[model samples]
Each structure stands twice: as C-alpha cells, then as structure tokens.
Target: MHTPLSDQLRILLGPVDLADIDPGATPGAVSHEQTEDELPKLAARLDDLQRRLFAAAQGGHSTRRVLLVLQGMDTSGKGGTVRHVVGQLNPNGIRLTAFKAPTEQEREHDFLWRIRRALPEPGEIGIFDRSHYEDVLIARVRKLVPPMVVGRRYQLINRFEQQLTAEGTVLVKCFLHISRDEQMRRLLARLDDPTKRWKYNPGDVDERALWPEYQEAYRRALEKCSTDEAPWYVVPADHKWYRNYAITRLLIEALERIDPQYPPGDYDVEVERERVLASG
Candidate 1:
C-alpha cells in the first residue's frame, strides 16, 4: 500500500509522462515562505533520524542504509538540493558521490561496479549526484552504447536495486523535474553572473539541443526501473525552496517508516555505570 506521503509527492512506481508534471507546481497552496519556515524543522527531524540509524548500525542492530539518487538535467538545482536538503545531516554519516564521466578504468567494468563500491555502509546515507541511470540517460541520448545494450541495462539496474533492497538498503530516487524554459533561464543566469560562470559548461548548450531525446530517455528509465522497493519521485524543482522542502519531507517520512532506533548496550548497563562511577 502506498503511504499518504508517497501519493502526495506523486511518487512514480509505474508509467508516467514527463509532460504531465508541471515543474512549477507545489503541493496544495504551499508558499515559498511556508516552505522556508518549515525547512529547519524537517531538517532537524532528518538529523535525528540519521543519528538513530547510525546508532543502530554502530550497535549492530541495523543493516539498512539509505541511498538517495538525484538525477536531473543541467541547471535543475542538483547541487542546491544537496546543499540545502541533505546538507543538514551529520557529515560523518553521509556518503556523497558525484558521478562524473566514467574513467578509462571505470569504463572497463560493468556500469554497476563503481556504483556498487559507493553504496552506503550499514549506518550511512549515500547520496548519488548522478548515478548508474546515466548508462541509460546520457548513454541513450548520446548513443554512447548500442540500443540493445541500453535495453539490457534497464533490467540490470532493476536487478541490482532489488539485491540492494533485499540486503537492507532503502532507495529514494528523485528526478528534479524542471521545464526547458526554466533550464534555459538557469543556464543563462549562470552566464550572466561572474561568480556562477564557473558552473557554465558550453557542453550544456550542446546537450540542451538534445533535450527532447534526454526527456524520453528519462521517461523510459523512470517507468521501467521504479520498483516497490526503490520507487522514483519526480520533484518539481523550478522553485528551489519548494524542492528542498518536498525532498526533505519525503526523506523524513521514509526514515519514519524505517523507524530506526538506538540499540541497547550489549554489556550490562548497571555494571558499566558502576564501573564509570567508581573510576570517577
């Protein structure tokens, strides 16, 4: 059964048309001010949840971890989301990997090899800036791989995620949905501001030309790979504040469901306390 939270975020577990989602839409009439006001509270809750999850793992009571896979086109605020939403948590418990173009060494192995190595440990939360989905997304759009190979990768990804979930890793895949117009605006903004110019890539304009193809590739990937254990959520990211709020809410709700609790001490608590008291 879908939780109310899942339904609220339009979590994608099946077929979905990218065109159907308005990138500017927010849940209900939520305002940017409201979202900003609530963000700290949600972030606090997320921090507590993360601590409990880590504590459980330290005590050898939790094998479950969280993997947050963030995917979006250029200028969709992937960096901003990481900064505002995920930045609140304890850095020690967070494992962040920003996937770049595969190295020659990485290319030699199957797509999942590097990704598998980066998976969060039992107590940690792993954040993938761009993940194995690139094998299907950019590879499909750029024809980096044969169609038959890309087709096979979808199945491989699903099986890989299934294995992760079976072994106790929770997955939250988010597509930071932004419209073409908004993307162009952001790209142009990057060019206009000297400080942001470093973020501007001439290659982004080249990719922008292939926007439709990328969208289709993303659509297919999201539809085919969203499983019960690892569903994808389309986050309307045109409004940065709302995007942070929504993603933070989704994460808090997910952790609540997991309900990680600090494990009891293995040794006798009273004896340990008495020993400490005597030493003092």
Candidate 2:
C-alpha cells in the first residue's frame, strides 16, 4: 500500500543531502499494497482537488501562476508524469510546454526568451518538461559550452527564476532522480519491446557512460538553483509509480494552498433563489 499523502509528503520534502544519494543504486518498483492497489483512486482524488483549487482560484480573483519544472536524466519518467499526472487537468487553465533543442528562431534570441514566452497566464499552471536549467545541467555534463558561459548561465537561471517568483509565479522545480542500474534496465526494455522501442535513443547509451558526470552536474544544478521562492525537489525515481504519486501529491498541496474558488454570484441571494424556483 502507498503511504498516505500526509505521511508520504512528510518524507518527500524533507532535507536531502545530495552527497548521500547514490546515482548507481538500483531502485525497485512502486508498491500499492498499502493503498489497496488503488493508484487510480489516489490519482483521481488529486485530480478532483486540483479542479476545486482551480475553481477557487478563479473565484477569488487570484493572479497566481504555477510553473512546474521537471528535470531528469533519460528514462526517469518525465514524459510519463506529463501524460498521467497532469493529463486530467482542465486544459483551458493548464499549459504543458516541452523545451526541446532550440530552433533557428529560438537560438537567435537569448536562452530565456523562449521560456519567457511560454510563461503561464494568470490563474494557470505551466509545466515545463525540461526547462531553462537544461543549459546548466546538460551543458555542464557534456561540456558542450564554454566554462565561462556555463557559469554565467547558472547565475542567469537563478535570477530568472527569482524574477518569476517575485512576479507572483510560484515556481516548483523537481529533479527525478533514478538509479543508474534501473535506468539501464528501462533503456534495455525499451529497446527489446517493439511497442516501446520508439522511446529509445542511441544517445541514451552514450549518456549512460557519463552517469558520474551527470550526477555531478545535477548536484551543482540543485545547489545553485534551489531557492526560497523557487525550490528544487529531488524525487527518488527508481519506482515510476511512486514518482507519479509524489508528483501528484506535490501539485495537490501547492494548488490547495492557492485555494482557487469560483466567482461570486452577481445577483441578490433572494432574487437568485426566486429565479431558480421560477425556472424549475
């Protein structure tokens, strides 16, 4: 059974020492024994709560926007979380943006221009599959860019996120930390299964060889980017199902705090009741 949200989250958001997490350890599958084998039930509860929060947000005339940034190595369930966790949200109020390799126009602009363009409007949730931190994480890992440039980018990202938070956008960054061995298992499974083969990339193996480098990059990324306004949550992702639960729970808590509500009725209470009775 899964841990109740209250219990599970008490552990999930506690202090994490990056040095103690072994990137090479093997993570097992998620268990539902405690949750009555009802992953769907838990997920549904989260969805319903989110909708209520959205309605409350609209009602309260709240301008808060939520930006959920997800980062992880390949096969860490970033795509799956997007498909499952946020899939049931009201499409009108949520925006899902995947930051891919820069296009010609995007590359011509500053690194943050595309991201700025994708920011969520008032009372909306914006999810970035991979976000501005990519410049720091991937670039530092591969040494694809100059050292000076990477250093500058990290500072820029921190300032960028700070600005967003200061402007009423609640930023939540999550790093999906998966074990090296489990990653290899998932990668191989993708290759062996024809239906799942599409997820495999030849570059995944190449990147697997640099697991240590990636870990170092992640350590630094979290160290530099986690802040009072825009904190980073490093989730243990060996178990995809647990990862999903953690994500849904995180979002639920955040939305509940925002406490979105429907707009008040414009009509007088007595008149409104009379109108309802007349219509009936």
Candidate 3:
C-alpha cells in the first residue's frame, strides 16, 4: 500500500529539528518529470473535490471549508507554490491573503483579529501566504513582542486552530524548509537578473545573517503549535518541483478526507427539464 504523503511529511510527534531533513530531497522516490506528469491528475482531482465543496455550500448541505497555511523563510517558494499549485484550482472558490507587517490599526487589536477577518467562508479554500504564526515566529526572532508574550501566543494559536477545526475547517499547515546554501544561490540569481532584481531586498541579507535565530523561532513555533487538529508538514523546498508536488498532494489529501457530497437538487430534475423546454 502506498503511504499517504501526509504521514511522511507531517511532524506528528517531534521537537522540530529543521537540520535533520535535507531540504534538497523529498520523502518519495518520485522524479521531477514524474511530478510534472502527475500534477495535472492531481489538479483534476482537486478541481472535482473543490467544486463539490463549493456546490455543497450553495445548497446549505455543508459548511465545510479548507485553509492552507504556508510559512517559510525568504525565497522559499511560497509564492511560487501559489502560482503553480493553487492557480490550478478554481479562482472563484479561492480566498487568498498574504500577511505582511501589521498595520498600526491592526496592531491595535489582538494578533488573531486580522486572521479571523481573512478566514475562508463556507465552501471556500483559504490560502495564507504567511499567517498568525508570525506573532510567534518573527515576533520572537525580532523581539517584536515581549518574550513572555511570545511564549503565550503559541497556546493562543493552538486554541484558535482547534476552534476552527471544530467549526468544520480542514487546516493544512506547511513549513517550506529550504537550505541556506540554496537560498544564497537564489538570492544571487535575483540580483543577477534585472527582471528579478525588484524582489531583491538589502534587508534580506541582514535577515540572512540571523538565520540561526529564525530557525530557532520556527522550531519553537512548530513544537508548541503543531497539534492533532492542525499538524505541521515540513515540505522540502530546495527543489521547487518537489515543493510544489508535495503541497499539491497535501491539499488533495485534505480535500479527499473531507469527501464533500453534492446535495440532491431541491426541485425535481424532470420538472426542471420540462419547465426549461416550455420556456424555450
């Protein structure tokens, strides 16, 4: 029996050590050409499931929803995954939000307030390019909040996620694990290509200097917040194809598990057909 990729990539029980796994590699023996070939099949399946989810919600048959939480270091291909993977799903059912530095108004509220506003409604698939975890990750790394405050947000996040799942949201949390060496190469390439230079940030190099700190932040976040309701999956991301493939598989699995059933038509099909014919 083929083991689901979720079991392989998910951090079920761990003190997350990012160094233990190779970011350049994948959990499966699948090849790049194979992944490319398999994506269309995955997309087609995902499309059918997503449409079922949307259709179910339209008839009030289900309140099912999906939320894909993506977190990673700079140049870890979060955006790339969205373009390559999420773009394959129906745009009408997607609600995407890329969280950035908190605005002054946003800072006035609790960390999760903005997150709650961006959550997917019934039958929609929500994508968070970065998320509430920032309250613990960067907030701890940069000392944006007090150490004690950072300590508390972990439990807060866990409770929040638990409540979401209780209300029928399937949460797929992914940490795009990339290596330092690969990140340096990509940074250099960004500077080398004029079209990409716009994405190059001098601050990125400064952030790179604090790599160890950031990794520790990630470890703490994963350790404290990864729960049965919302487990974290470490996606090997040095290989762009594998990262995309892994995430696509993760989404497919989550939706399949939901197994949304399209509701029966409220009106008789034959009557509808006759009414349509007479109207014509």
Among the numbered candidates, top lDDT falls to 3
> Candidate 2 on 243-276: residue-level lDDT in tens?
7767776776666556666667566989988999
What's the CA RMSD for each of the models? 1.9, 3.9, 1.1
What TM-score goes with each of the models? 0.96, 0.83, 0.97
Ranking by TM-score: 3, 1, 2
lDDT of 1 by residue, 61-95 (tens): 68988898999999998899899888888999999
lDDT (C-alpha) at residue 117 in model 3: 99
Tell me the spans in candidate 2 whose CA falls farther than 4 Å from its real position: 1-19, 22-31, 36-45, 56-60, 266-280
Off by over 4 Å in 3: none
Clashes of each: 0, 13, 0
Candidate 2 lDDT (Cα, whole model)?
A: 0.75
**Between the candidate structures 1 and 3, which one is better when assessed by TM-score?**
3
lDDT of 3 by residue, 68-156 (tens): 99999999998998999899899999999999999999999999999999999999999999999988988998999899999888889
TM accuracy, model 1: 0.96
Q: C-alpha displacement of 51 in model 3, angstroms? A: 0.9
Displacement of residue 261 (Cα, Å) in model 3 is: 1.3
- Say which prediction, candidate 2 or candidate 3, comes out ahead on TM-score: 3
